[model samples]
Structure formats: structure tokens, C-alpha cells
Target: MSTTKTCVRSPVPTIALCFIVALFEGLDVQSAGIAGPAIAAHFGLSSSMMGAVFSASIIGLLPGALAGGWLADRLGRKRVLIVAVMIFGVFSAATAMVWSFESLLIMRFLTGVGLGAAMPNLIALASEAVEQRSHGQAVSFMYCGLPLGGALAVLISNAGLEGSWKAVFYVGGLGPLLIVPLLCLWLPESSAYRAQKGRDHSAPTRRLRVLFQQAAARPTLLLWVSYFFTLMVLYILQNWLPSLMMSQGLVRSEVGTVQVALNLGGAIGSLLMGLLMDRWRIMALIVSMYLGTVAALAGLGFSSQFYSMVVAAFAAGFFSIGSQLVLYALAPRFYPTSIRGTGVGSALAVGRLGSICGPLVAGQMLATGSGAAMVLMAATPGIVVAAAAMLLLVAGQHRNQR
Candidate 1:
């Protein structure tokens, strides 16, 4: 193995800058959820219509993920990230101003495109900036901004602001706007990416096809499968857990508190897992999956016991959500720098399909009176699936080396 003597240090200022940008990106992504109730009330919308509003953004995300990766590979990560942030911010503000449902949906979809594009580039940038050994920790630390941002949204909403949910959108939109100039000034282009792009000799299509082909081999396939199911469970929890608690007669403030706890646990878990990754990569994955599975089951089976429920939620957040950060950390190491962005972005893009399905499936199941137990139980398959996939990946890696 060839190791570079670059000895890149993740400076506090640069990481802080990246965290703020990532925070804005996360807030923008979750703003719709914060604003959904008010929007529905304003428009006298049906539940189905409200669901469509939520779905539109995710629909835009699919193409955005793929396109953003390709763009970052071509134009550079910093440039694409800044542009996406600006686009999302602009559309988010536009969403706040729009009166018609159709217009709001259109703006939301556009914002999703920006939001989706931002994440992969952020991952690519963070992964490339750090030394290989510290890759997992750096990426996990960077992604901690996500759950923190979501928690911030809940806090802002709870403060009983005067302008209703529209205020959340305005704030969410302005966050990225504020960060854009700072990002341009402080965020450097990925040095590794720049070097690889300079050596590019093939058509972009050929390049992409080749990258996808490389990803089709055993370990890559296993990683993608693991990522897909993990995302499914994570997204389901993110979108439905609050509502699930609310349905069990928990007050809105308590529901928000649960979300905060979940996020806090996730942040802590990511940091811990990052450290563990360097020492026991495969063992860390197994432990995370097993913890997630147990947490899900516990949360579902003991919905009425507030403390137990919270503990279960915390465990789920700690294991499942943080595992995602671990996945992003591991992704760059799995592929060479030449296709790092593509590999990570494609995994994220495909994983997002599972994210979309998760909420929808949970919604249907909840309607059928599946209860918290069923919902929590639903998460088990995802963990088991992910664990099996990881084992396959490990086996594949050993075979490849041999």
C-alpha cells in the first residue's frame, strides 16, 4: 500500500466552516417537515396532498445525487457544493414566499436538488481533506452537523415564534445564504480530486461506466446493499418516530425532546464509532448492527414506558444513525481517489431510494394499526440485511487480497 506523506491536518477553522455549511444543508433538508403542518393548514390540504409535498423534494434528490457527483468530478467539489448550497437557499426562500401549492412543490423540488447535490460533495470534500487513517473520524464529525441541525429546527419551532412555520423556512433558507460567502472564502477545493481530474483522459460517460463497473465487484455490491437497508431504517426513524410518539399521547414538546435525545445520541455515537473504526472496523459494524436491531425491538415493544422508550430511541439513534456516518467514512477507503466521489455519491443516491420507501412503508403500516411494536420490528430486517452484507464485503475483501 502506498501512503502519502501529505500529513493533512483537519484544521478547526476549516472543519468548523464545513460543519456550518453542512448544518445549513441539513436544516434545509428538514425544513419542510417543520413547516408541513402550517402549510397544510394554510392551503386546507388533504393528508395525501401534504404527503406529496414531502415526496417531491426526495423525488428531486435522486437525480441530484447522481448529477452532483458527476459535476463535482468535472468542475471540482468546492464549486459544485457552493452552487448547490446557493440554489437550495434560494429555493427555500422562494418556498416561504409562495402562495400556491403547485408553486411551493416546484420550489421544494428544486431545493431538494440542491440539498441532494450538497451532501455527496461535502462527503467527498471531507474525505479527501483528511489523512487516510483519520478518514472515518473526520467524516463522522462532519456529518454530526446533520442531526444537530435537525435538533436545532425543533428547538426553534418550540420557541413559539410568531410567524408560524414559514419562519422556519426563512431561517433555514437564510442559513445557507449566510454560509455561501464564507464557504467560498474558506473552503478549499479537494487537492486529491484536482490531481485526479487533471489525469482524466476518457469521455465522462466512459469514465462513469468504468466507475460503476468497478463498483459492481463483490465488496462494492455488499457495501451498497448494506448502505441501502441501513438508510431505509434510518430514514424511517427520522420521519416517523416523532409522529409515533405523538400518537402515543406524548405532547409536542416531549416529542421534540425525544428527537433531541436521538440526535444527541447519534452525535456521540458517531464520534465513538469513528475511533473504533480505526481499531476494529468489522467488529464496529457488527456491534452497531446488533445494537440497532435490539434498540428497534425495544422501542417498539415498550412504547408506553417513557424512559424505556427514550432509551430505546437513544440506542437506535446511537447505533443506526451513527452507523451511516461510519458508512460514509468507510466508502472513500473502498474506492481509489479516481472514483471516490462517484462511488460515495452513487451509494448515497441508491440508499436514498430506501429512504423514500421507509417513510411510505411506515405510513401505510401505521395506518393499519401496526403500532410501535410493528414499526420497531420493521427495522430488524434492515439491520440483519446490513450485517449480512457487511460479512459478504469482508469475505470479498479477503478474496480480493488473496
Candidate 2:
């Protein structure tokens, strides 16, 4: 597609709308973790059972991302995104009304489907809406909403809501539902997607096949590896951090403080990485990011003092969440507009697998008598693998550019 026809005249409105969707997504994603303890107690759930609850949404995410991306290629980013937002919104609100463990799992799984589907569209729209040179910043800016919304979820959790854990869901659900109208009025379909739609004559199977053909195969595999390991670490932190901190001697209020710090750091890290992604040396930045992640994980493991844990949480959020944002920005560049949603979605779907594993592994480890430090340290090797995969992916992209 021609650059002029591919990109919108102004990306702000599209990116802004996508940001709103992502904000709610972040809230819903973190809501399960924020509300975990109360829900576990209310339902009398064991650690393994609670891990199942955490994995339910992620399991739904795998298919949701796959189908959502496929539909976006056929239907359109805006249409698919709207339906996704609605599905998650209704289900998230329904989460508060669940009367049993099964119902809670059902509601959360449906919410995960919506969240999964919406993410690739957000990345696709944000990247396609802007000039190629600005893709990194555009997607990063939109993605920062996720961590900021997580911060918002933390605040709501602590906001004296009569001890009702359902309050976070109500806010997370209603915000997305309310934003649908705004999206209808303001969000534009990706110009690139529109241009390619009529020309995309390949069948769905063919599109899937292309992901593994010749040069595409390596990056696709590497991206999946990077996503899987990185997300495993991230989801572990997101879902288990509060309980883990409490187990390590922090109070509820202090854990809440660390959660806020973690999220705030995520928001800042996303924007910071966005600015540097397009300008900095790729390999060096990748090294630094992963190294920081390792240090943060160690800090979270060893730090028993309240203030030290808070600092560690911030660093953890900064590098771990920030690395994911960087990956999101990079994914769009590997595929053209026609299959961009599919490519990104497939990557995200694979990442959700790690997401599912993270919480489950943490739960099992804790249930089996692993310490918080042991659980935290277990993630280091995966970080090393993710960093290596990303470096190779970047090297390939540079070679292609040459």
C-alpha cells in the first residue's frame, strides 16, 4: 500500500480511542489479582483452585486473540474492536455478580476473550494510523494506558468500598461500556486495512501458512518465544505480587502502595521505551531492559523492608511491563497491514499461554512450599531466553532493512 493511503491524516483520534479501550483492559486484567484474596476467601478456594481462576481468562485469551485477529482482517479493526470491548465490558460487570467459583471463572474467561481480541486491534490501529517512523511512540503511548489503568485499579481496590471486592469490576466494566459510544462516534478504521481488504484474496488457511513460510518462520517463532517467556514473568508478578508481598510480611496497605508504584513505573517505562525504541541501538537497549528485569526480580525476592520492596516493585513494573510494550511496537513492523492483526494476535495468543502458566506455576510452587524468593528467582532463565530471542529478531529486521 502507498504510504499516503495506508496512514491516516491524523493519528491522535484513533490512538486516543484505542488508549481508552486499553485502559479498561489493563484494569480488568489486574482486577482479578486485586480481588483475588477476597474471592479466594469468599469461595474457600485452595491455591491450585485459585490458579485455575487466574488461568481461565488467559485460556480464553488464546482463542479470543486468534479469532479476533482473523475477524479483524476480514471485518475491520474498528468493528471487531467494538464488539470485543462490549463482550469484555458486559462480562466484567457480570464478574461482580457471580455466586460461585464456576460462575466467577466463566465471567472472567469471557472477559479475557474480549481483552485478548482487543489488544492486537489496538496495536494495529495505532501503528497503521501513524507514519512508519512514529509507530513505536504511537503504540507505546496507547499501551501506557494499560499500566495506568492498572494503577487506577489499585487505587479503587484501596478506596474503602465497604470491603466489597466487586467494586473494581464495576468500575472496570462500566468504563469500557461507556466508552463504546465514544468509539462509535470518534474511532476511525485503519486506512491501511481498508486499502488491503479488497486485495487480500488469500484464504484464512493460506494466511496462517504464510506465517511459517521461508523468511517469516524464524521471526514468527522467535517472537512467540519472546512473548511466551516475557509474559510468563509479567503475569506471575501481576497476579501473585499482592499475596506474595503479604506472605513476606507486608500489610495490605503496603502491598497496595507497591502495586501502585509498580503500575506507575509501568506507565512511565512504556513511554520512555517508546521514545528510545526508534532512536536507540536495539541490541544494547534489549540487554539493558532484560538486565534491569533480572535485577528487579532479585530485589523483589530479597527485599523484606517495606520501602525496598516498593522500589523493587517499581523497577519490576518498569522493565517487565515496558519490555512487553516494546515487543508490541515491534510486532507490527514484521507484517504488512493485511495480515498485521493476525500476526500480532498470534503472537499475543502465544503470550497468553505463558500468562496462563505464570499464575498456575506460582500457585503450584507456593502450594508445594516454595518461598516467594524461589518463585521470583525461577523466572530469571526465562528472561534470558526472551532477551536472546528479541535480539535475534531485531538483527533480522535490520538485515531486511539493509
Candidate 3:
């Protein structure tokens, strides 16, 4: 697949491609959550073993993200993304036929390679597609596909679909297959990426080094800290909310409904935050973090009733998931184009570590069965307070930079 030489300018097609990519990515992620019980039942695996299976994917994501970012920078965003989509699609289907737990873990880990690689490419592509001023809106809009795709996966699985767990993977696998042809036809190479590639490679490397040094050194350290903590909370909620609700004695149908509500809230949050980001970047972040703090606390402790739980779940999804999507949108603006992929990829790779720990910690807590719920609730205040402090530091640094 040769990269497109001509710069394409249509936002609609570009956004459509991003949405499709995000849809399949979200489908693959949500499939595991939806199918966890079935997989455990079929294999008679303990919760710890199940956690390992899910973590396998995250483990693969670490390398996938780093490699995908480099590939997008070196080759082209469109090419790498198409390859990733196909890889995940094929492996997800293959996972359905795995005869044992170890086999399933290996397959999912391979699929995670594809899944992790696909996301940063989407972010980079979307960021490059639009004007700098509109970058946040563009990225946030594209990421809406994440929550929507997740919601679709849950809804489809909940609809019975022959009551087979494998159906979830089938749907997830088919999504990328459907998107690949369109991607080949419509997706365009990023102009910014090409411009960067055309530059003196050594110059770009130097610039990247400076950017990282700046980011890691003083002022930007706060941004990285906030980014890490925010993702820790967000990923934990996304990966475990359904299971947590089930632990609360909700039926599977109710779990699906709550998941849908949460995702729906995320969709709304992404759009709202994107708009807000354009006008008030720092203020918007602060407000979203505060909302996330409240929602998380509410979701963990209160909300015993079905409707109340749904509301709390929706708020949690909106604030936590929504805020992180906003952060991705805003990330590119903080760094120069020379090292944009590296910066974003590094942040995401670090966040993936947090994501990896989240499920494991939750599983261990569940196993202990003492103060488990409270401990989970405690993640909210701890993360939010840290995030708030970091953001304040970032704002102070920005003021000083000015």
C-alpha cells in the first residue's frame, strides 16, 4: 500500500475513518469485558486467572503503542493503522476457537498488539487532519467512537445474539474487516507526518530530545503527572465497572444497561469537553476532574438503587472517560510536531502501565473481600487530589512561561 502523496482536506471522510478505527478498537476492548464470565465459566478459571487473561492484552498494548507510534512516524499513519486493524480483526476471531485458557491468553495478547498500535495512530491522524486551533475538537470527536463502540458491543451482546459468547468476538472481528476496505480507499497520509519526514531527520531527533527534556524536566512534569493519574482512574473504571456492578448483585441485563449509560455519558462528555477545551483548556480540565472525583465517590459508595446507580455510573463515565479523551485532544498542542507522536506515545505507554495495574489491584481487593469497595472508592479521592494538584502546577508553569 503506497502512501497517498496528495494532501487530502475533507474533514468528513477523515473523521469517518477515525470513527471506524475507533469503533473496532472499542469493540475489541469491550468484548473481553462482556465475555469474561463466559470465558471463566468455560475454563473454570479463578478470578486471578481471569485477571491474567485480561492483563495479557494490556501487556501487549505496551509494545504495540510504542511500535505503532514509531511506525506512524516512519512509514505513514494510514498504512500502520490499516495493518493494525487487520491484525486485531483476525486475532479476535481466532480467539473464539481457543481450546484452553493459556491459548486464549496468547491470542488476546497478540490481539492487544494490534489494538494498542491502532489507537495512537488514530490520535496522530486526527490531530494532523485539522487546524491547530481545532485540534481538541477533532480529536475528541474521533474518540467519541471509543465509548460508542463499547456501548454497541455491550448492546449487541445483551441482545442475546444466539447466546454464544463467541458472538462478541465475531462482531468485534467483523468491525475491522468492514473498515479495512474503506480505510484503504479513503484514509490519507498525514501532511504533518510527511512534512516531518521530509525534514532533516537529525534535526527532528534533536527537537524530540529537547521536547522530552522540557516535558520531563520541570514545568511539564506536572502535566505528565496529571495525565498519568487521570488515566489510572479512567482505565480502572472502564475495565471494571461492569464487574463491579455485578459484585453489587446486579443482573447481567442491568449490567449491560449501566454500561450503556456510562458509555452514553462518555459520548456526551467528549463532545462537551471538546467544545470547552477550545475556549478554556485549563479551566475545563479542572472542572472535569472535579466532576470525576464526585462521580467516582458516588458510584463507589452511594447509589444502591438501580436508577441511582445508573445515574452515578453515567456521571462517572462522563467525567472520567470524557476528561481523558479531552486530555488526548489537548496533548498535541503542548508539544511541537517533531516529537508529537513520541510525546503522546510515551504518555499512553505509561498510562497503559496504570491500566495494567488497575484490574490486578481490583482483583486482589475482591479476593481479600475486606474493605474492597471502600478501597476502590479511595482510588477516586487519591487520584483526583493528585490530578488537581498537578493541573494547578501546570497552570502556574504556563503563567510563568508567559
Candidate 4:
């Protein structure tokens, strides 16, 4: 099934667009966390309530991803992506208008839906733009926007927002709207999608019940389990690291700097590993990355000094978040383009659910009077388990191919 391969003369433009959308997702995903203090202060909320708010968008993301993927497979990746960007953009901007706790929760949940819809389609589009073998690097390059956006969120919140948390939402929200036209004008639809549509017009509109088809069932289950554990640890840190550090007696001001380091490490590691993935045994490389994260998490558990914790955080981010990005790069390869969006979206839906559980679970762990160090140490093994799942996934995938 040959596509109108002319939709992409090069991968750069497509990647750039996906990168921008991913950046928006990153910003909004981090928006609640970065603004956590302000939001709590403004609303006079409890830790449990804050946890609910933190989980709101992520919960919304669960269904958003499922529906978005199903639609993108049929409606067109570009169209789905554009609508997704708009959904998040408008909702994020509306976030600034919330005057109460419940209002903020609703707005964030709506915004999450938009964010969830955009990601899988962006992943699918970017992978489709490049040649098969180069997909690892291409999708990795595209996902770097996530970490970059996280870094930018910290910068924007502290450097530019001037203490008003609403300012951060304003930037995270309306900024994506301005990018929509550029996407319409420049970002091409997935040529692979077009080819699939050409072959069977009816296929595009079908529901996503096919994820468990005989050929896909094993990888799908493995992908879901791996995604669940990885996202659990990743979001636990993303949402709670500052609180954890503060609980341990670290200076309050250093939190932002440490977050920047963590995200910077994620960006660097993602690019380097992306290249290696195209050339190495992907399971071995990914497992090693998670193992390094386990060690870093252990380091963070014991580190009493400021600089050491920062270094440990950076390594944790470098490996865990970076490994997750590689999984994004790898997702499209496991399924045919016909259901690519569903495959990736399904994997992420479970992960998003895990993300919702992550912060809440961390909150509960802290509630039990556990020290930050002990909690982190306990969580490290979850990532180890996720790495094991990926090892099995790679073995099953290889066996299936043969």
C-alpha cells in the first residue's frame, strides 16, 4: 500500500509540528504541578484535594486518548491533531478564569482531554513522516519537546510569570492556538493513513476493539503493563519531587533548578538513546536505562546534600523519562499504520490511568508517615519491574515476527 509519499519530502517539518504540539502537552501536563503551590494557596485546599486536582486532567486523558486515537485512525491525523491542539488550548486558557477549586478541576480535566488527544496522533504523524529505520531518532527528536516544555514551564513560571500562577496557564493555553494555523499550512497528514484509507475506506471509521487481535495481544498487554509502571514512577517524581525534597529539608528555592536539571537530562538522554536504539538491541538498552534510574532513585533516597540530590534527580530523569520517550518512538513500529493511533493511544491510556494513580499513591505513601527517602526507595523497584516487562515484550515481539 503505497501512500502519496509526496506528503513528506522530508521529516523535519512534520517533526517540528509534532514537537510543538508535544511542547504544549508538556507545559499543561506540568502546569498543575508547577502551579501547585499557588493553586493550593489560592483555594485553601488540602493535600488530598490537591491530589484529586492533580489527577483530574490525567483521568480525563485516559478517555481522551482512547477516543482521539480511534478518531485519528479514520478522521485524518492532521485534522485530529488540530482539533486536539485547539481543545487543550482553549481549555488551558479558560483555566485562568477559574475562581474556585471545583472550577479549576473541571477546566484542567477538559484541558487534559485535549492534551491526551493530541499526543498519540502526533506520535503517529511523526513516525509516518520518516523512513522506517530512522523512526527511532525521528520520534525521539519529536518527543524531546516534552522535556523541553517541562523545562520551559519551570522557566516560564518563575522567570516570566512574576508570581501569578494564572500567567503560566495563559501562556500554556493560548500559545497553542497560534500554532494551529502553522500546522494546517505545513504539517502533512499521515501518508500511511491515507494509503490505508485508499485501500479500504470503511476501515478508517471502525472502532478500536482490534488492539487485542491475535497478532497484537501480547505486545499490547506487555506495552500496557510496562507503560503503567513507568508512568507511575515518572509522574510520582514530576508531581511530588519538590514536596519530597522540601520534606527532606532541602531549600525551597532549589526545587526549580533541580527540575530544570531533571528535564534537561531527559532531553539529552532521549536524543542519545534514540540514536542508539536504531542501532542496538532496544530491550537491552531500555532495561539498562531503567536500571540506572533505579540506582539514581536509590541515590536520591540516601543523599543528604543538596548537590548530590540534584545529580541523582538528573540521572533519574535522564533514564526514566528518557526511556519513556523511547517507548513513544518505538510504539508505532509494533502495529500497522491502520491502527497505529489506537495501538499507541491504548498503551498510553493505561499509562495515563497509572499517572492518575501515581500522585495519589505517593500522597498516600507520605500520609503513612514514611520518610521521602523510604518512599523513593520503595518506588525504585516498580521501575525495575517495568523494565522486566519490556524485556518480555521484546522477546515476545521477536518470536512473533519469526
Measured against the true structure, the TM-scores of the candidates, in listed sequence, are 0.91, 0.97, 0.91, 0.94
lDDT of 2 by residue, 1-402 (tens): 656555227888999898988999999999998888888998999888989998999888999998888888989999999999999999999999999999999999999999999999999999999888888899999999999999999899899897568999999999999999999999989989988887786776888888898888999999999999999999999999988998998878899999999999999999999989889886888899999999999999999899999999999999999999999999988887878888999999999999999999999999999999999999999999999999999999899889
Tens digits of per-residue lDDT for model 4, 50-163: 788889998989988988887887788999999999999999999989989899889989999999999899889988998889988888888888888888887877774455
Give me the runs in candidate 1 sitting further than 4 Å from their true place.
Answer: 1-13, 37-42, 45-47, 201-204, 212-216, 398-402
Question: What order do candidates take by lDDT, descending?
Answer: 2, 4, 3, 1
Worst 10 residues of 3 by lDDT: 199-208
lDDT of 4 at 86: 96
Q: List model 1 lDDT by residue over 256-352, tens digit each.
A: 7777777777777777777777777565566655666566557645668777777777777788767888777877777777766676777777777
Candidate 3 residue-wise lDDT, 1-402, digit = tens = 788687557877888789878977887887787778777888898777877877888887878877776666667788999999999999998888899988999999999899888888888889889998788788888998988988988887788767467887888887788889999998888878877785535443454465557444453455566666676666666666776778788898998888898888888888887777777756657666566656555665566777877887788778777777866876666666666676676666666776677777766776677342564575775476546755676576478678
The CA root-mean-square deviation of candidate 4, after full C-alpha superposition on the true structure, stands at: 2.8
Q: What does the lDDT come to for candidate 4?
A: 0.84
Instruction: Give the clash count for each candidate.
Output: 0, 0, 0, 0
Error of model 1, residue 51, in angstroms: 3.4
Error of 3 at 172 (Å): 0.9
Best by lDDT: 2
- Residue 257 error, candidate 2, Å: 0.4
